[model samples]
Target: MNVGFRVHQDVLRPDRALLEGFAGAAVGNLSDAMHGLYTMDSGIRPVVTPAARVTGPAVTVAVSPGDGLMLREAIGLARPGDVLVVNAFGATDRAVLGGTVLLAARDRGVAGLVVDGAVRDLDEIASLSLPVAARAVTPRSGTSTAGWGEVNVPVACGGVVVQPGDVVAADGDGIVVVPADQAAAVLAAHREVEAAKGRPSDLASGGEARRSRADVVFHRTRAAMAERGATVVPAAYHRWPVPPGPTAASRPDRA
Candidate 1:
């Protein structure tokens, strides 16, 4: 299938400035930002470097049985800076991406793809050096390639709202959604986090305790536990360790 498109970098205007770069700030950490990050259930490991930048707004597709074929047309509709995001409705084992569809995106220079389902053609897609994010990898191909989709629609990739023109950033850590309004703010927050992180990791680990403050909470906790026949100890007093065994109340014969 032949696809055609070109994007002027000036028109897209992706932020390429060098900032207080943190190692993993560009993409939101899943642990802290679970609502925004979509986890791919992939075993084939689509590891991409940060240099794989995104430029366009998102072109969201909610895929059904015959929707896989719309990818070719999606690429045709997408300009250089667009990301093709697919909602597969949890059909992760069957491949939603293939060699043919990938060629269409690569040829048109679409930035990348994010799918909430499975994708195949690993070796071939990798050879083309396409940036793709998906749930898993499988040998299974979509049953049909017929067009069944809506253009410029909103789709959910694990609760993250992907709309047309939203910036989708993803790397090994995970994918993060930045609504057009917050894209610049997220970037600013990223720079601040990186700046703070520059302080030695050891410094954060060092002197993390106030012996007096901990003693109060520990003693209070221990006293409460002891009332219920349980033993507790604070790390500050290593010698007074809590005993590990069934207490008198735990043994019926003793009662």
Candidate 2:
């Protein structure tokens, strides 16, 4: 067995309609539906504002630090609306993809690219308008001859274990991964959340309902804290155990 250098040609992707259900869904909502899990770290951000939220099955790629040989291969294998999620060992000093390569992925109908390492060619990338996200940007390029990586395999990108065919969604806010098997349930939960919030048009007139929901959560949290023996006594800062510093009025003016 080649171990780290092998590729698995087949990935179990979610149904097309299931993937389409995630289109235009907010990453925040998806994260919330997952109970605040499956969100990529904040450091991974879109290199450019994507034309829309990129949502599709993940084509996972694992690469040796500072190399992109497998990334290119993944691009070639990707079908339309497949997101290439690259795990580059979080290397930031060398970019694995640049403008030219990103253009190639765009031309190949790749839905988007997310790298845990670095990428360059910001200007050209923006011009191409493909949805690309990475942890950093650098001009230094990596050598492709290292040739140690895998494709269509599970990888850790942005502190999350991304399996091939897991649904990946990214927008300006950030990226979130939905386990392939849980897509339908998460979508149902997301719909429930939206329903509870009422329609976007009703939000302006629903301030009271929003406040009521917040109060319920706040009081529940306070009750839990009380059961945990936590207590708070409101007091002015100057009245605390430590002696208060001189007040502004008591300090001598420089003038």
Candidate 3:
């Protein structure tokens, strides 16, 4: 079986602080923070949120269907600020993204997309305002019916593995799969990343280091607990979203 698609290797990655700075930590917290986030799951039904573009906490899709036509139907359902995530159900060599589909995604206000397999329309997908990231490009296209499949269901994709509604972040550095269970923590992590990194940046800007020994202890404790697979440490001290620079992130009050 063939799957996946083509995309720009020069894609851009959003700031990890930007991804983790959201104060809203629930399902509806980043309701409007819809700009980025993508999954590499195959047969995903990516629906674009009709709301304004959000910069953080973008819930991605993972579909494990065998049908390629329904996949296109899912793309039709997307609104705006959405990055369509598709998994070709173990088909990485087939072309799922082509000129026509890329145009449709763009016309529907979709912002971007990611696939773990291959794509056919290279020049056109690149030209659209919608950003696409994938593994390879091919001269092939998806079969109207590759047999059977489902939409909106959880499916494993890419190297990290993913499920529907899991938050995804993609950029030039590649894509990060944020589990739905970890969304709040991941979203919360960005703040610390920004703050931790910001401490250095502030000093670089001739500002003082506001962090204290207590803060160091806090991170150390969290890191220790996390290393043991405990929930005591948040993503801030664990991994990703790393520590931010002194500048930190610019976020509006979510409350």
Candidate 4:
């Protein structure tokens, strides 16, 4: 079996409706629904416009630091509305993606691109208007040699394990991974969160109901923290007195 150089053709994607539910969802709220986990590190941020919000199944790619052969193959294998998630071992010295290949991916109907490595051609990429999140950017391009890498396999990107076909919801906040099998449950939980924050319609209508709900939640949380042994000081930490120390006048002068 070609371990590192193989591609798994079959991937289990979640239902289209389930994925669609996350289209305009905030990554932060989704992360909270998952117990504040499954979020990519802050370093992996939107290199493109922050207004871009995308949700789709992930096509996982594991590429060597300075090579992008497997990534190119993954793009061809990706279906429309699939996010190409590339793991390049967080290498920043060389870029594994650039404008030229990004154009091809865009034309192929790829939803977005998230890389745990560098990428170049920001101007062209912005012009394309495809959502792109990466760890860094560099002008040095990767080699196209058929090297060791894997596609549609579990990979670590930005300190989170991403599985093939997992729902990837990315926005200005960051990227959040929802396991394919648990997508339904996560969506339900996310809806509950939104409800607790007050319906979007209420907030949009400039009603006080949303603010009231927020206040309730904030006070409840504060009380819970106190009950759990969180001490509340009457004054700020900076206003507290410092330990006694010898004053400059009390110290002996040096010759």
Q: Which number leads on TM-score?
A: 4
Span of 10 residues, lowest total lDDT, candidate 4: 198-207
Off by over 4 Å in 3: 1-67, 199-255
What would the TM-score be for candidate 1 when compared with the true structure? 0.62
Query: What tens-digit string does per-residue lDDT give for candidate 4 at 31-84?
Result: 989998999999999987655989999999999987878888898898999999
Tell how far residue 70 is off in model 2, in angstroms: 0.7
Task: Give per-model CA RMSD.
Answer: 9.1, 5.8, 19.1, 4.7
Residue 7 local lDDT, model 2: 88
> TM-scores of the models, in the given order?
0.62, 0.80, 0.54, 0.85
lDDT against the true structure, each candidate: 0.61, 0.88, 0.51, 0.89
Candidate 2 per-residue C-alpha lDDT over 102-218 given as tens digits, one digit per residue, 9 for 90 to 100: 988999999899999999999998888788899999989886746799999889999999999999999888999999999999999988876665544545566787677667668
**Collision pairs in model 2:** none
Prediction 4 global C-alpha lDDT = 0.89
Order of models, best lDDT first? 4, 2, 1, 3
Off by over 4 Å in 4: 199-205, 225-255
The candidate scoring highest on lDDT is: 4
The per-residue C-alpha lDDT of model 1 at residue 168 equals: 68
**Ten residues in a row with the worst lDDT in model 3?**
45-54
